[model samples]
Target: MTPKEYLEIVHIINELKDTPRHCVTKNNRIESVAEHSWRIAMMALLLEDTFSDVDIDKVMRMCVIHDLGECFTGDIPVFLKTDDDRRQEAKLLDEFLDTLPEQLSHNMRALYQEMEACQSREAKIFKALDKLEAVIQHNEAPISSWEEHEYDLQRHYAFDVVAFSSWLSELREEILQETEYKIQQEQ
Candidate 1:
């Protein structure tokens, strides 16, 4: 990569350095998007053992790249998206991806679309863990920033998370349960 390309990537990473996720660690501290991405990738690798039908590499790649667009769009919470807002976000993500070299841009756009489509097993697992990580982070963090976004339990249930939606649909419950358990242990 040229210095210019490297600097752009660095700038994106820097922009996200302070952006907090919906979850806090067990110690009640905020985690950055970079940390969240790293954990999600780890989750994809760990869950690969159970998802025999999924392409683990593809799933991991999807998880790692899923939020790259957020580097530009910022972390727009799922519940906050109106129809027009979503359409604009989609356009922004595509346009941002297009800024890359031809092949790289194509690949990133395709991956983003595949993730949104969630038609494949890999996409399914990635989406599931994405929610899971957010809830987990919220539990560990000091603030209920996620709740402030109005992403209540019902909305989460209504959201379509593709392949594992039926099975992993209780992300809201999982987050609350895990948070409760952690709080109890601390006491």
Candidate 2:
């Protein structure tokens, strides 16, 4: 890709840094889509040792790019996101990807498809990390930021997503403990 093409792609992706997500930070600031993506990528990096049988590098790449769809549609919380929201984001993301150089676009398009399918080990791990990261972030945020439904969500969400791997399942259990502790403290 030419420098201009690379820069253009970067320019497009830069929107994610500014896009607000549903989650709030501990400091009471709204979280950005870029921040969430970076944390999930880091989660993949730190868990690489446990996933030696899987392609850690590919998993990390998926973590980073999985939310590129949100750059165009902004972030719709998983709970609030509807089928039409998914369709719109997918369409806009495809349009954005079309602007990239062929190889990069093709590779990311394939990765997104794999992520959606969650059949591959790399895809499964990336998907688990994405879910786990949000749960983890919810624990970090003040209890006051949570909606009534979020109490149940934080406790129960992502258990199924992480169940594909024993290690990830254990991690989800740990988050469940944190959620219980947070709720008890709130009471």
After TM-score superposition, what is the CA distance of residue 88 in candidate 1 from its true location, in Å? Answer: 3.1
Specify the poorest-scoring 10-residue window by lDDT in model 1. Answer: 150-159
lDDT of 2 by residue, 109-165 (tens): 999999999899999899888988998999999989999999889988988888878
Candidate 1 lDDT over 86-174, as tens digits, reads 77757876776666778877887788878888777777788878877766555555543445443354234424553355555554556
lDDT of every predicted structure (CA atoms) = 0.68, 0.91
Q: What is the TM-score of each candidate against the true structure?
A: 0.74, 0.98
lDDT assessment of candidate 1: 0.68
Give the distance in Å from residue 59's predicted Cα in candidate 2 to where it truly belongs. Answer: 0.4
CA RMSD per model (angstroms): 4.0, 0.8
Clashing pairs in 2: none
